[model samples]
Target: TITEICDRYPARIVDVGPKVAIIEMVGTESVLEEFIEEVRPTGIVEMIRTGVVSMGRGTRIHDTNFINRRALADAAAKADSGNGRIV
Candidate 1:
């Protein structure tokens, strides 16, 4: 199962929607390759590599909650009006 695989690897399940799921994992190249191979049979539709985190460079946190809320509100409005466009 995916849960078991995640528990065994250095992976974390970030979100699971009705039709999609997002997972985050970090490790060496070999470890990542092995993990991917193990999960290839689980019907993965898409994979996106966002960015690399470096300890030497530290990390910057962005407060994007408000932006997400605004986007969600716009999407809801569009849906309610049957326009299919976010304004």
Candidate 2:
């Protein structure tokens, strides 16, 4: 039922628990509003429970080691010179 709801709506399944689901709909906020209104009674937990800790928009986790090394080097330089803070 949860999968069906997500597929039918323009929503993303953010998280799923044994008895709950957290979701987000990109556009058409009205659709998501209606979904929440109807599904809230189903005992599903919302992401708001955790205060919605989300990565900033367009953020991506890079698995490349070289990129990570560069980032660390830049961070060290900035910290040593008090030029900037590590992100």
- The candidate maximizing TM-score is 1
Worst 10 residues of 1 by lDDT: 55-64
TM-score of every candidate relative to the true structure: 0.56, 0.42
In the range 30-68, model 2's lDDT, one tens digit per residue, is 765777776666665434423334574433444457678
Candidate 2 global CA lDDT score:
0.66
Local error of candidate 1 at 42, Å?
A: 0.8
Residue 2 deviation, candidate 2, in Å?
1.3
Error of 2 at 8 (Å): 1.2
Q: What is the lDDT of residue 56 in candidate 1?
A: 38
Best by lDDT: 1
Q: How far is 47's C-alpha from truth in model 1 (Å)?
A: 1.0
